[model samples]
Structures are given as C-alpha cells and as structure tokens.
Target chain A: MADASSTAKYEALHNGIEPPSFKLPLIDNPEIVTANTLKLVEQTPDARKRFLFTTLTRYLHDFIKETKPTTEEWHGTLKFLSRAGQLSTPDRQEMELILDIFGAEALIDTINNPPKDSVTERALLGPFFTEHTHDVSNGDSIASEGKGEYMYVDGRVVDTEGKPIANAVVDAWEADDTGHYDLQYDNGVPDCRGRLRTDAEGKFNFRAIVPIAYPLLSDGPLGELLLAMNRHNMRPSHLHIIVDAPGYEKLVTQFYPSEDKWIDSDSVLGVKKSLVVDLEQVNDVESAKALGFQHPERGFKLFKRDIVMRRKVDA
Target chain B: MADASSTAKYEALHNGIEPPSFKLPLIDNPEIVTANTLKLVEQTPDARKRFLFTTLTRYLHDFIKETKPTTEEWHGTLKFLSRAGQLSTPDRQEMELILDIFGAEALIDTINNPPKDSVTERALLGPFFTEHTHDVSNGDSIASEGKGEYMYVDGRVVDTEGKPIANAVVDAWEADDTGHYDLQYDNGVPDCRGRLRTDAEGKFNFRAIVPIAYPLLSDGPLGELLLAMNRHNMRPSHLHIIVDAPGYEKLVTQFYPSEDKWIDSDSVLGVKKSLVVDLEQVNDVESAKALGFQHPERGFKLFKRDIVMRRKVDA
Candidate 1:
C-alpha cells in the first residue's frame, strides 16, 4: 500500500497541483546506471528514432566510462558543446562543422547513401546549400562579376542506362577567386550558385569563375580544434552539384580541379578520383568562339562531367 | 607553379588579410575524415586533455559510423543536446541530469574511484550538497519544526580497525516528507539537513523527518526521455551522508529504508543491498522519554549505521 504522504501527493497531483521538479538522485553505480538508462528508452514508436537514441545513449555512456572525465573536464566539454549549439543558426550550421571535425558527416553519408554499381560516388552536400536557389537557363553566368580564371561548365543528367533525363534539376555552386562562397561575403546571395533545368537533350550549362582552395573557419571553436589537432583546414577547389530528376535518386557531389595540390589531402575529404576533373584550356579562336567566349586569347577553363543518377528505391 | 589566384589567396592569409569565417566543408569520406580529425587535437600541453580529446574524437566518429542518422534525426538530437546545455544554471544543472539519464555519472564514478577491500562504497555527492552545513550537537534535532514522520538517527564513524575516531565530521541530508529537498522548497535553508561532529566515542546523532521517495524531473528533455522509455522516475527513500576524519578517506554513501518498494528501482541507481536498513519504531512512552521525545507512545522511527573509512593513502 502507498504511504499516507504518497496518497496525499497523488491527490495533489490529480487536483492540478504541480510541485517543483528537481534532478534525479545520483545512482553512484555505473553498472546499474547503464542498465537503468537503457531501460529508459522504450515507448518511442518510431523505429528509426528509437534505434538512433538507443545507439547514441550507449555510445555516450561508454565514452564517459572510457574517459572518466573529472568534474572540471566534464564541465569543459559541456561548455564547448553549449557554445557549439548557441553558435548555430538556420544559415550558420556550426554544429555541422563540429560534426565534420569529428568526422561524423562522412561516416553518416557512407552509411546512409552509399554509391551503387556504375553510379557516381556521392559527396557531402555541405551546409552552404541554400534552399530554392535562383533558377536559371542553360549557359547563364551565375557569376556576379568578372573574376579569376573564367570557368565554363556544361553537363548532362542521365539515368544509369545512359538515357537522357530531361526536365532534371541541376544545381551548382562554387567559391569565388578569393576562396569564399557568396554567402561568406557581404554580397548576400550566392553569386556563383544557381539552379538550371536540363534542356530537351538533358544538357545544362553554367559559367562562373573557377574556385580557389581555402581553409576552414580560422576564428571559431572548430578552428581552435584544428589548431589543437595540428591539421591544416584547407579544402581543394571544387564545384558542388546536386541533380534531382523524376524516378531517379537525388545525386549530391562535388568535382575538384585536378591541378589543385590540396585535391589529394582535401581537408573535408570531399573528393573521389572519379569526381576530380582535368579542365582543358583552349586559346584557339575557333574553340573559344564555339563556347561563346569574348576573348579567345584568355581561354577559359572548361569543366565537364555527365551526371549518371540511379533509380530511387523505396525505403 | 601555383595559379595567380592561389598565390593571391595564400598571400592574403599570410599578410593577415583574413576573410570572414564560416563552417568547414564536409569531408565526404569517412577514412580521411577520421585521419584528418585525429590530427586536430594539438597545442594542448596537458597530457590528460590530449588523451581525452583524442579518445572522444574517435568515439564520436565511430558512433556516427555505427549509427548513420538521417539529417532530420541528427538535427533533432543536436537540438535536444543544445536545449540541455542552454537550460543549465548555477541552481539547475540540466547537463548533469542528462549525464545521469545517460548513465555516464555512474560509470565515471566506478572507473575513477574503485571500491577498496575494506573502504565504504562511494556514492556521488550530488549537487544538492551545501558546503558548511549548520553544525549540530549530539541528540539535537536537525529538523526545525514538525514535518513528516519523526526520525532519529545515530551513527559512529571509524577506520577499518573499528576503533572509535573522535572529531569525525558527519554530514547528512534527506528529502522532506513530500519528497522535496529544502532546496526544492521555497521555505529557504534545508532545515532538515545539517552536519555534526562525532564525540570522543565516535558517536553522532541527528533528529529529522523521515525522507520520502521521489521521482526525477519529469518536465524537461530528460523527463520526456523517461516518458519515452515508459519508466517510472521514482527514487527510493534514503538519507545521504558523508563522513570525513583526519588520516582517513572520506566516505560518501546513502541508506535506503527497507520499507520502500522503490528501493530496488531507485531512479538514480544509487541503492545497494548493503545500504538498505530497517528502522525500528519505539512506541513505548519510557523509550520516547529516554530519547527526549515530545510524544509518549507515538515514538519516532530510529535509524542507525556505522561508517567505516579507510586510511588515506594520499592527499
């Protein structure tokens, strides 16, 4: 039987009286703690979510056990995590960068969206992709102004069987000559990023400045972590692309210029040998004119890649 | 030769013309991501800190690989963690609660402070402990006024030899009759909790209200988590104690009243079979008068325990 006090407490609860809430008592025993904590994850109906929490809960307990952090160290970690969360915004995904530094993004991508046979290797879509990018027609210059080595890119979206997929959405973005994305600058909109619909032949084209390799954030906690790690934060120059079409898998990838030295040690590990393109330069007047170039002598670097998407399977 | 733009970017970085900072790029490959991330924990002169970060980084990546959460799920987890951190205050230690729910606290305690052959088993001191509790004399009422069932506790603290150790400090605290600590109530100082000095015979006494079993917080993320787990948040009724003396290890522990059904299911996992004790009710008027009781025949419950401390090996 419940004690008289317990009965009174229940009555108070039923009568709309909520007492102040406090933290649970310390179990002080690790074995029971893990067992009891694992028992706390049951009623969630969503299988995927439940699985995620269970795994995460296990990992967290194990990490703590292995580390055995002192109270000071524990507080330090909590502070760092707190700063990471507080620093995040809709546009600024600092937490994602934290995951990158932890190498979580790459692992998750490999696990959830692995490449299939004869399919192009996928890369991280990254935090910079803005939803509803400005729509454009083929051959439109996504660049806001003349800068660096002129880059000309034309690609096609096709099924794995090589059949042209018209009406496909081809989205592309890259950094400017200064090794910065449009969002990183005061210019606001990503001048070198846009979307285009594939033509009747499944072809899409975008003209912009070739991107320059650059380092990651150098003034934040992530940067501090990199400094602590003694690792260079540089990434190779590349163009990011995403192609979505009816009945096909949404492809997210990036293509690095082969000549960039950082390509081999791309900080974010975003490169696959198949995704690296060897750009061709043509100073010949005829070749430049065919590409609608205003100056043949100042030949632009041509980057070409045909995206082959796989059929989407129902989850 | 480096491209002119590449040269310019390098020059800008070297010349302190640092551009704006943003999140790092996604590495895309788990192997390289892990390698690159492992290379990030440097500049820390503290060896323990270096070890901590290196292990944490590995575990984080491994956990992600083992559980490839979808973007939405990952974000949801991040948000939950963020909220936990944001909700923490000097008084409200939500992060600690999160740790408790995850079972980290128990594991850490076990790993860092192992049980010696003859020393008392340790329990977490918990955040509710107030430094410099009001000192009480033997047979004094630690309770300020009538609350719940009257409780009388007397204990002795000694080394493994079982010899009386004079001048030992015995600190004690317990929940009120309603399962609320003085800190949880608006009545101010924990009139139910205090510390006392052992007399020449290593004996101490404190009179207070019997502690009531209570539940963990059921209002925040941890509470929601408990709900999801479908587990009752109740903790068994117990009294927390700490005994310290010169040349002996401090002993921190709790004693659960055997009558409480939740003893085996203490939410904090703090209850051990050895820590359970039965309280005796003395209903005789003469016995009540002998113990300075205000009521005859309606005697209070009496609790008794002897604390065994080990010789301190080091400072």
Candidate 2:
C-alpha cells in the first residue's frame, strides 16, 4: 500500500509568492468569485498566458452558469475526465480522442490553420500517426503482399502558384482491410505505412491496400460519451498524409473516399469537401502489372491527387 | 512491461450505435464543426443531458475560438491534465484541486446551491475531508493534548425561526496549529477531528486546537498553475463543519477566523463574508479550567456561533 502521508511533504513548501496587493471583497456571491479570479489572473506577467487564462476562466464560468450542473453531475464529469487521462497511453491517446470526438480538436485545428486559397486545408493529426514508418522508394509498395486488395496512390507536391516542389518528404498511413492500423496488431512492425521523398518532378506513387472504415475505441470514456450522445463512433475510410519541404508551410491532410458510408459523419469531424476524392477502379491487367502488383489480373483501384502547399512566409 | 497489444482488444468492439439519419454538412470550416457537434448533442434522449452537453459544447467551442491556443499549448494542456490524474490517489484528489484552483468549483457550488434567507451558506468540501473520523461526546476535546493552543467551540443547530434542533449531528474537522490534518500525518489514525450529536437544547460544544492558516500542496500541477498565474496558494485558518438533522438540508461549510491574514484571499475562493467568525480570547483561568484545558493559566480562544439551517421544503 502507498503511504498515506506521501502528500504531507508538499504541504510544507510554499510557492514563494505573496498575496496580491489589491484587496478582494469577500466572495459572497458567484459574481464576486469570478471577478476575484479574473483579478488574480491579471497578475500573470506574460501577456499570452494572461490572455489565455482570462478567456478560459470567462468561458468556463459562463458554462457553469448556463448549464447549472448539479453537484453530482459536476462530480461525475470530473470523474469521467480523470478516467480519460488514466486510460491514455503513448499509443492510445484517449485524451486527444476525447477532444476529437467533442469537435474541440477540429475547432482548434481550423482556427490555428485557417484556410488559404489554393492551399490544402489541414486536418486532425490523429492518434495513429507514428514517426517509425518504413522508407520506400518511388513505385514501391507500402504494404506487404496479401495485406489487402491492390491500390495505387499517386500525387504531386506543388506550391500554390502551381510550381512543383521537388524532394518533398511524404508520409502516408492508413488502416488495413481489417479496419485496424498496423500499430493495432501485435506484430510490433510498421505496416501499411511508409515515407517517401518526391522525385525531381515532385511526383510520388506508392502501392497500398484499400483503406477501410473503422470505429474508434468503444470501451473507454470516449465510447461512453458517443453512446450517450446517440452518435456512432465510426470514422470514414481515409488515408492520412503529411508533407514537408523547406521554405514552405508543412501540409497535414487526409484523402477520404467519397463512397464511404460514414463520410459525412466522421466521428472526429475531420472531413472536408476539398479533401474527398473518388477512387477509380481500373480492370486493365497491364496497368496493375506496371504498378508491380503480385496479382496483375485482379487490377487495382487508382487514386490520384495533387497537393498544394503554401510558403512559410504566406502562412 | 505492459503488453503493447492490451488496447487492441478494445478496437474490435463497436459501440453498436448506428449513424444518425440527419446529414451533417461537410465539416469544411470551424463554424460547421461547432454546428455539427451541437446537432449531435441534441440527439441525446435525456433532456437534462442534452441541455448540459449542448451548453458545454457551445462554451467550449467559444473558448477555443476566442483563445486560439497553439497546437503546442493544446497538447500541453492535455498532458498537464493527464499528469494530474496520474498523480491523484484515493487520498489526494488532484483533479478536484485543479477545478478548485481554476475557480470552476466555486462557481458550480454558488449556482447549484443558491443562498436563501436565514440559512448559512455552503462552502467547498475540501479534499482533506475523510469518511473516517473519531466519535466524541459534546464538550470533549477533538484534538489530542499538545496538538496546539486550546480552543473551545460552542454552537447551536437551530431552524430558520430559531427553534432548537435536538439530536442533530455536528461533524467538525480542522488542521492542527502546525497546519496539518490528522490524515496528513503518517500515523494512519484520526485526530483533530470528531463527530458529535447535539443535546436536547440544540446546543453543541467541543474542544479543539486553534486552526492555523496554511498553504495548499504546492508540488503538483496545481502548484505549477498557481505559479504561472502569479497567485499565492494559502488558505486562511478555518474549521470545517457539517451539520445534519432530520427534515433539513445537510450543511457543508467552514468557519474562517476573521483575524487571519489570508482570510480575504482564500486560494480556493472558499471564504465568504457571512462564514467569517471572530475568535474571542479568554484569559480567565477559571474559564479555561471549566473548558477542560490542560493548562488553565494559558487560557483558550472561544468561538461561539449558532447555525441556521433551512428546512427541506424551504430549500
């Protein structure tokens, strides 16, 4: 058992800050409480910190006043938040998933990376993205044979002015036909994910399996919240890609297949009309053969899109 | 080491809920994201829950839009919250402490339990309260000898109209003069805290140590937050008490000594004007002897107040 007095040591140390010079009236009412809190927050020396906390306090207090949650409900909310944190792991980002499901992540992403004409809109950097992807050469397959049906993804990285940007690093990841990422399996190896640098013409192509729609974790607090809200926890099938090049704003985006059933109601609110693309089924065996598919006779689905990035100065 | 595949098991289980029939417009912008989230929240069958979540979504989104915290700041927030939960134990409620320091708890309490005429206002039931406490008779000392300077507390539990409430239970607890609760010590036994019943005349009196002003735990995320906000972490000296009786609302509150230097600026925003009381110094040896102090010559501080409880119907 843990020692009960473990927290006692913290009680002895002070933050070394003295009381505020201004006198606060007794917090006899709710308004006084808010006023006093804001007054104290104003003491922050950093302008950005002060503004962020002041705004947060105002919105939080407004939420409490408008919702008027009972004591039990408030306690339950706190318990749920704590459980979300406790369930989070390096691979399983339960807290971020909560923010995603609640649409907060989407909102923040949208605000920070606002849309620019001719520049690809940013999307949520989901919990599945990993830096340990295998490096593959052009026209190489990101997935091993038999992972799923054949799919060829090709795209060109270019500036908003339509100039190709050569040697741009592209990282792509997606769930397999089983609706699970490579990291979800016990094999402890990166699969159905790869990193490749664009050729001299800013062109890149990778052979992969067809991505499948999947559900977020349904056993944790996020699942419970979705259930309570009477919403499905399924995300539309999409391929996540991040492109980076010097002297340009990094582009983080996703390509969603328009035909997916959950395309409109992505649980994370990550979908955009501009990002959705149609996959063409090409039955030509020669086309699959040229793409290095093991079963050329089965043909392959072709996905082609050109990514537009903005310069860092423009951003 | 924990198995990496432990979370994979949860991935296979879906929430068993179908997508809503309504078509959410493509979430191409921040406005659409917030609109879709509120729409989804409206699907909740429970009226109260729907209202609460809808309000919460609005304020949360508004906060995000107003503050526009950078991606790094947002991630930092999630990490801080997760650390708070990880550090919390059965005895240490780091999550609630976060809410307290942020002033959310005070606002919730104020809104949910609005004050009524002739009734004592409630205060925060701080994290130090425990279920296990010693049962002491009236007029007996709650603290052991040498705990602190002698103090005699006398109070009556009465109705709003001043009628006596016989057999009412009064639970009293406080930190010692050294600014620590019994639970804060490693002894693992209750001290400086007790539960007692009122007499037929609705009178209750107890002997205890003089409560001392103290700083809150300053080694956790809460401390970091206070330091960042440029605020102190001190709570004024106060005795915690809970009075319960038949056909009346249970009162959870604290009595702050008016003379304490920190009385006006409670770190948790718990102090109220009506809850403040003055401790009368009694120097007469006979008075101290009658109150059962070990050294009558040293005398004792006297705290006397009558608690007015609102009836259940009135509340």
Candidate 3:
C-alpha cells in the first residue's frame, strides 16, 4: 500500500495533478552513489565526524576519478593495505609510518596544532613511543651499557614569556650508536632511553650517547613501496621527547643533530629547522669533571635546548 | 673532502666567481617532500608504476589540503581502514565493499569501461562470489534441498548482431529464500549456484530458488556506518551471472527483479535499467511439463534474458 501510494504520488506529479516536491532525484550513477554514501554519513550526530566523512567521501571519489587505476592496480592497493594493517603491532606502528611517508601526519598536525609563538616545534610522535621510560634524577645517564658517544643534554621548560616552568616531566628516547632503537634489540629494557623532571629552577639534564642516522624498516609492504618509488629510507640521528606539565599542553617532538649526514634526507620528513640542535664538543677531562662523570678522561658532546608549552587544552 | 669541496663550490657561487649549476631548488616544504618521494619512485624501471605513484601522491596531498581533517579524525580514518582490511577473508572482500560504498569501484569501472555497443552492463562481483560452483547439465536445477520459490531461467549468449554464440559458458549464483548467501552459513557446499555451457543454438536453462531482498553484512563497520547515516542497508532480489565465451570478453553482471521493493535503492548502487527483468508467473501446467518439471500444476515464474558480449581484448 505504501509503495502504491508513493507510485501514485509520482504519477500524480507527472500528470500535473499534484506539485512535484523539492527533492533530489536519483539519476546520475556516480551522484546516486554519492547520495547513498552521504545518506549514511548524514546520520552522524557528531558534527566533526559528519564533516570528516563528508570530506572523505568527496575526496575519495575525486581521487578515483582522477587516477582511474586499473582493476589490477586497485586490487593490489587493497592487498598492500591489508599487509600494512597486519604488519602493525603494539610496539610497531606500520600504518602510522605510512601516514608519515605520505606526509599526511605532518600536514594534519600543522593543521590542527599550528606551530608559532615561542613554543618548541612539535614533531612526529613516531611509532616507537613507549611511556615505559623510567624516570631518573637530574644529570643521570639514560644510556644503557655500550651505546653512542657520550652526550650531555641540558634543557629548560618555559612559557611563551620564557618563565621557567618547574617540575615538568621530560621523557626521552633514541636509537643506539648503531642506529637501532631499543625495541629493535632482544633486550626488554630500552637502551639509550630515559626520563627526568625539571628542577625548582626549571632546568633538567640527562646523559646519553649520540644517536646514529639509520634507514627505516623496509621489510614490509611500506618499505617495498618506498623502494619501488625510488625514495631513500634513512632518518637523521635524533632524540624523541615528550614534555608534560600541569596546566600546559603536552609536547611531543624530536631534536635532530645538525652534523648528521642524513639531516637533509630524513626519510619520514619530520625535520624542522628550529628542532635541529648544534652539539658543542668539550674536552674529555674537563667535560667529565664538570658533569661529575665517572670517566672524567672520556669527553662527550653537549646540547642545550629550551622548550615552550601551550596552555592545557588549547586548540 | 667531498663536503668541503661542495661547500667551497657553494661559496664560490655565492662570491659570483662561478656559475650556479642547474639544480632543483628545494623551496616549498611539501614540494620538497614530494620531490624526495618522486626521487625514489624514479628508480623503478617500470614506467606505469612510476606514473601511478606520482598521481597517488598528488591526489593524496590534495585531499589533505582540501579536507583539513583534524588529528583525531585522521587517526579515526586510519583505524577504520585498518579494521576494514582486517575484516576481509577469502570469501569476503571487505575492502572491495568499502570501495563500492565509496562508489570508487563503480566509478572507476565506468570511467575505464564505458557502457555502450549493446554489451551487458557490468555489476559488482560482490563478496559472495564463489568459484566453488558445480558445473551442471543444461535444464538442471541449481537449488539445493529446501529453498525459496522455484523459478526457471533460460538465457542465450549472442553477439551484438543477435547471432547465437554456441559453447558460451554461463555461470550464475544467488542467495536463498532466507536472504542468506551460501558463504554466510556453515554449508560446506553452496546452494543456488551453478554454471552451464550454451547448446548448439546458444541457449541454456537452469532452475533455482528466487533470491530474496537482503541487507548487506552490517555486523561490520560498514553496517555501523550505514546505520549512523540513516541509510537502508538492503539490496534488492538479484541473480549474479557471468557469461564467458572463447572470443568474447567476460561479462559479470546481475539481473534485478523489477518488482523488488529495493530494486531502485540497491545499497551497492549496482542496478541498471537494462539489467532489471520482469519475472512472468505461468500457471500453465503444460508449459511446466515441457520444461521437464515433475510437478506441472505447481506453477513457477519464468525469466528469459539474453546477454551480449564484446570481443575479447577490445579496448
């Protein structure tokens, strides 16, 4: 009865017995598909999500129309996506790396959290971030046995006005001298990784070896894709850091060594000019004595950097 | 020494003592990233793949810029994609369905293979396609055990000129009365699925239960998405068919019951005007007996549709 009534309504409208309602007619094939897709997205009560799906559908359709990938290419893309999902783990984020490779991650971050003002530039959190970093007192060594060349890192947490922010939690991690991260090795405890809190004066310090530049993990489909695309897989030596303090926004970033060979060729494309720190090399004996190192005769480089934080929950 | 020499060359250029070499200036950040990405793809000797990746990066970046999805929204999309990939199995093509949902698959197919020249309209193979179908003799029933209302189908494979194409292989599949596809249940073997070859006159016949209108597998994220979007998940009653001949292009398509309530609202957007068949009910006992049905008085619907094929390898 309902179908008949609707049919009659359409017939009446066609025969000029009734006015045609102002409704979109389902005609064009692609348009019909878009209408159907949007029909589902329209039900989203969350305004943000609704907008996101709308844009996703539009751009996805646009991409397909523009690319016109063959059936085989389409199927192969699906297969590659499946492999990427399967390659991910709790510790390894293959899909995240894919986003970095595509430059979406950095672009999205820039969109959501624009970098300006006096705050430290936010870089990629990357796939290897593990909060398992054990906190130590200031000037403590995060370097596990047999890591990179000894390096001293002294930094301060501050507001836009450069006011020292005391008690900020500074977590840090980096790959070893061989360019392999701690998780890449058999040892459960992370090597060349540690955390420390800001002192009353807002200054914090930790000792670790210099990070080594290395290539990304290319054994998976992403790696194979990069290789096929003729892109380098290397990242410059850097230290990942996350700073958290009450009443301030969380800061996730990394600082690169200015002298690293791959500094200009970082594979993940997460580099920023301000984030690169110039290491100051000091005499071995003088440096060890000043920093109270057990091996006073063995000198290490020093890096000093200051970080600024936004207010908590700042958009 | 190499670094020193390069620095000296730059210094000489800066001092106006040497001509600057023709080099790609890395100005734009995103462009630099793209250039680096292209650098790797350039290593591939395969020209087609190189072209594909080049377009992929362009469109991907364009999408990000146009949509400006928030960090959370981007992450959510990645999660949804990962789930879609993980949800797939040998019998189910979840990603393919996702493509259909986004209308990319249909749009791409249309763009690549335009509909014209009397060729059969293409339809999605859908996740339920099974090559496990048994080859049956002509006029044999494909309905297994107890199922939906019985129907007789006779079809002919012909060229655009209407001449019969003998020995053409006809494959057919559909869901049962309960709206459950063969792959959806525990049945090791499928019902309502079979293939036959054209006779001397290019005619083929089969008996099967009428497929009922059914919703797609909405237990997955796709279902949740549709429900959220306030769209019906149902697809109209249809029969999936594939016709193949030695010198003809393989045709994968479906015929929709014109009377089906959801015929015009197929969730997959796969229905076409030429593919809708009007099933004719025949209570004629004499005709049933002629068709070799044991119970002639128990009437059955009859459908006769002809399929036209294009030459194999035609562009």
Candidate 4:
C-alpha cells in the first residue's frame, strides 16, 4: 500500500522561471494561439534557437492550417513518432531511418555539405559505418572465404589538380551477397569491411564481396510508413568508401553499381549520378593469382575509380 | 552466447512493395531530392493522407531550406524528440505535453472544433480525464475533507435557446490543493472528481476543493525546453467539466477562476476570455450548514455558471 507522499512525487513542480512580463491576449482562436506562441518563442535566450523555433512554429502552423488534419489524423502522427522512438535502440537508429526515407537526412546533408565542382560528391554517412574495422594491407581480403562472389576495388586518391595523395587513409565496407552488413550478424569479428592506406602512387586496393541491394528495416513503423506511401524500401547495391588526409577535406561517398535495379530510387535518396560506376568482369586467371585469390581459376568482378579530394582551406 | 541465426533476426526485411515504375532523376541535389519525394508521395492510396503528407513534406522542406540547421543542430533536434518519446509513459503523455506547450494541440482543437456564436466555447481535453469517477448526488461533496479549502459549485445545462435540459449528465474533475490529480497518487481510489446527473430543472450542485494553479511536469526534456526558452510551465487553475445528453453536442470545457495568478499565461494555451469566471466568497453560516460542512461557520467560496450546449444538428 502506497501513501500520499508516494504519489506526491509525481506532482507538478515549478521550473523556477516566472511568467513573461509582456501581455498575452487570451487565446480564444487559432490565430491568437499562433500569435501568443510566437511571442513566447521570442523569449528564447539564444538567437539561433529563437530563429529556428520561430521558423519551425510558423511553418508547422501553416501546415496545420493548410492541411487541416483532423484530430484523429494528428493523433496518428504522434503515435507513429512514439512508436518509432520505442522501436529504436542504440544499434538501430529508427529516427534517422525515418529521416532518411523522408529525404530529410539527404536535404540536411546537401545543405551542410554543398558540392564542390572538382571534389568528390558527398553521400549519407549511413547508420552502418563503424570504427571497429579490420586493418588490412593493400590487396588483402576484407571478407573471409565463401562469404560471397569475389570483387576487387582499386582506386587512386588524387587532388583537385589530379596530383597523387600518398599515404591517404582509405576505409571501405559493403553488404555481402545476402544483403546484410557484418554488424548485422552475431559473429563479432568484422567482415566485408576494412581499412587500408594508399601507396606511393596514391593507389589502394581491397578484396571484398560484390555489394548487394538491401531493404530498409520493414518490421517497424518505417516499413508501415513505406507501405502507406506505396513505395519500396530497397537501396541499390553500392560500395561505401571514405578517404581522409590531414590537409585535405575528408570524402565520404559510395559507388553504386550502374547495373543495379534500384539505382534511381535508392530509398534513402543517397544516389548521385557522378558517384555511379561500372564494374568490369575480369576472367583472367593470371590477374586473379596475382591479386592473391585462393582460387585463381575463378574470375572476379573489377571496380576501378579515382577519388578527388579538395583542400580543407577550399572546403 | 547468441548464435548467427539469433542475430539474423534483426536483418532488414522487405515490405513486399515493388519499386515504382516512374523514373526518379538521380538525387544529386537538394531540389531533386524534394522533387523525387513529392513524386513518391503522389502514390499514397488515400486522398486525405496524400494531401496531408504532400503539404507536410513541402512545409518541412521549406523549413529546412529556410533555417539550414547545421548537422549538429539537426541531430540535436532528433535527439530531443527521441528523449521525449523515451520519457513518455501511459500515465504521462510527454509528446502531447510538447504539443501543448508548442501550441500545436490548441491550434488543432481550434481548427477542428470551431466556436459557435451563441454557445459555450470548447477547450482542450487535457490528459487528465478518466472514466473512473465516483457518482455523487446533487449537493453532495466530491472531494474528501481536508484536501483543500472548501468550494461550492452549481450549474445548469441549457440549450442554445436558454431552455433547461433535464437529466443532462455532468462530469467534473479538478486538481486538489496540492495541484495534483487523484490519478497522480499511488492510491487506487479516485478523489476530487465525480459524475452527477442534472435535476428536472437542469440544475446540479456539488462540493469540491479550491483548485490550485499547477505546473506542468518538469525534470524531463520538456522542462529543459521551457528553461531554454525562458518560459514558465504553469497552467491556470480551473475545473474540468463535460456535459452530454442525447441530441446535444457534448460540451468539454473548463472554467478558469479570474483570481488565479497564472490566468493570462497558461503554459498549455488553454484559456479563453469567455471561460474566465469570478469565484464569489460566501461567508454565511446558514449556507455552510445547508451545504453539510462539518464546520458550519467556516463558510466557502461559491461558483455559479450556466452551460449552453449546441444541438448535434447545429454542430
């Protein structure tokens, strides 16, 4: 049996701030409600926050007025948000997933990291990227044997002027043939993901499985949202890569295989025309043996491209 | 130790919807991303959802473009929403609280339930209403003794033409002197609330404690939001009531006492000018004795108001 004091703990407590000295008209109508809200928002101490909140309030109010969502519809939106939050865990960011599918994450990325004509275009730093990567020498396999069909990725890190950037660190990861990242598996060891550095000629290479198109998590609200919108949830097959050097702007990007079916509608809206590349089929036994494939007779797909980086000062 | 099959459960699963047949241009720029999103939203099967989502997407995109929040700022917003969701429980609706403070809920109510020229205006149906209420006869006490200073309330339910409505059900509830709902306490029994039917003359009376202005829940993200905006979280003291009868539009409302200090700046934006009323002091001993007070000489505050409900046809 709990006492009154036990329930008293949930009672309202003042936040210590006093009411505003300015007069607020009684909020009898929707317009007055919006007016009073904006006035209160003016009290925000930080200028940036004040501006952001004001803009948000105005736009959100305008949306409500224009759409006139019924009480039921508005409640639906709130419930959707709550369910998304409940489904999210540290390893699975359901909120970011929602933003991604809505193209909000892409918009934010575009606004914050606008393109430089000569530098490699940016893409979403998706939720799958991890710092716990295996360090492999150039040409070593990132995936262990029998993971998937073999693929070789070799690229050169160059400046905007096409000068080789020696010793630039390169990081790469991809989904295996089953369309799942290494982190999705119970095995703790990293696979189909690795880190390597460019050699003297700014050349870097790694052995990995051919990346496969993957679906966004469809067992949650996000999937239901996609179903409601009548849209698919597949991202095109792509290889994730990051190039970093001290004096240069870090390039976070992905190379979508041109032949993949879902290239144009990449679910997260992460596909850029310039970032799409072709993977050439190489069946030469000599080439396979030289690249350290355990089975030289079995040919592999080859992807070759050059990464152009801009100077940090230019960025 | 978890096996590979156990970990596989978290892998992405498709929602079974095929990709749309329409061509989506490569989403290399922000404008293209918005264009593609709007196109995809056109596929919604429901007309209302289509309009609402389309309007929401446009406004949301415009807001993003206008504010151009940096990556950190956008992430902060997402984190704030996530925390609000995580903190919410069945007992406390933090999301609705956020909506209330932001004036979204008020705006929605106003839009959905417009006021009639001659009828009583509607107010927010706050999160505190419960179906479990004690049945009290007219002129009986609703609150247990010692909850707060005594108050007497009598009201009549009438039509738009000012005719008495017999047997109209009137439901009333309020916070105790401590500014806490009976449900907020761990004690399972209900207090400071009741349900009663109007007499043949449409008149109903009951005794309750003097409702106190209460603060919204603090010690959570909502509290932090208020502090950041330099705003207080208090709602003006008021009594919640609902009047319902066959053929009459249900009237959900609250009467704000003009003497409460927080009347002008209700944190929930729930106050309206017409709903404010004066609580007259009645110091007559005869009235206290007639009202069945244990200490007849103490006297009590008096509140009198007539509720006018619109017909369902008019509504």
**Candidate of highest DockQ:** 4
Model 4 spans > 4 angstroms off? A1-9, A294-298, A313-315, B1-9, B294-298, B313-315
Superposition error at A67 for model 1 (Å): 5.4
lDDT (10s digit) by residue, model 3, range B1-315: 123322211110111111112223221255555665445345555788877766776767777777777777777777776777777776556666766666667566666666688888887777678888889989898886467787899888899888999999898999777776666655456678998999989898998877887766666666666555555677778999999899888998989878787765565666666788999998999988887666778878898898998887755
Report the poorest 10 consecutive residues by lDDT, candidate 3 chain B. B10-19
- TM-score against truth, every candidate: 0.79, 0.92, 0.84, 0.94
- Model 1 chain A is weakest, by summed lDDT over 10 consecutive residues, at A11-20
Clashing pairs in 4: none
Better of 1 and 4 by lDDT: 4
Please give the fraction of native interface contacts (Cα pairs under 8 Å between A and B) kept by each candidate: 0.31, 0.70, 0.26, 0.74
TM-score of 2: 0.92
* Candidate numbers, best DockQ first, in rank order: 4, 2, 1, 3
The lDDT per prediction is 0.70, 0.86, 0.72, 0.85
DockQ of each: 0.28, 0.59, 0.18, 0.68
RMSD of each: 6.8, 3.7, 9.5, 2.8
Residue lDDT tens for model 1, A161-272: 8888999988888877777676565434557789889988899887777888877665556666655554567777889998899888888888889888666555445566
Q: Considering summed lDDT, which 10 consecutive residues are worst modelled in model 4 chain B?
A: B1-10
Off by over 4 Å in 3: A1-47, A131-135, A293-298, A313-315, B1-46, B127-137, B144-146, B183-190, B289-298, B313-315
Give per-residue CA lDDT, model 1, range B171-270, as digits (tens).
Answer: 8998777776666654355567888899999998878778887776656676666555545567678888988898887888888888786665554555
Off by over 4 Å in 1: A1-75, A131-135, A186-190, A218-221, A246-249, A264-268, A281-298, A311-315, B1-72, B131-133, B244-253, B272-274, B293-297, B310-315
lDDT of 1 at A223: 63
With candidate 4 superimposed using the best TM-score fit, by how many Å does residue B222's alpha carbon deviate from the native?
1.2
TM-score of the second chain, each candidate in turn, equals: 0.82, 0.88, 0.78, 0.91
